[model samples]
Target: MVSDRNMLANILRTELQIHKSSFILGSHSLICIFIYSSFIHQHGGRFHLSPLREL
Candidate 1:
């Protein structure tokens, strides 16, 4: 029974870590997109296709 409890605790801890990391990554990407869009907006809403073409 004690081993089962330990396993459950470990699983919960790993799950929390995964969620935290994912949230951080998601927020980072969101911020990047927001900044990029704002930059384009400042430039009269013209999206430069050169960068996409490079990709």
Candidate 2:
């Protein structure tokens, strides 16, 4: 029973980490896309990606 509990805890922890990482990655990509699109619109479609590196 103790081993079962430990296994369950480990599974929960792994799932939590996977969810957290995916959430962070999704938000970061969204921010990058938004910034890139806005930059393109502001600069008349010219592609200068230097500012995105700062973020």
Which candidate has the top score in TM-score? 2
lDDT of 1 by residue, 1-55 (tens): 9999999999999999999999999999999798778768767887776644433
- In angstroms, give how far residue 1 of model 1 lies from its true place: 0.8
What's the CA RMSD for each of the models?
3.4, 2.6
- Candidate 1, superposed: residue stretches over 4 Å from native: 47-55
The Cα local distance difference test for each model comes to 0.84, 0.89
Q: List the residue pairs that clash in candidate 2.
A: none
**Where's the lowest-lDDT run of ten residues in candidate 1?**
46-55
lDDT of 2 at 15: 100
Clashes of each: 0, 0
- Which sections of candidate 2 miss by over 4 Å? 52-55
- Against the true structure, candidate 1 reaches a TM-score of 0.80
Query: What would you estimate as the lDDT of candidate 1?
Result: 0.84
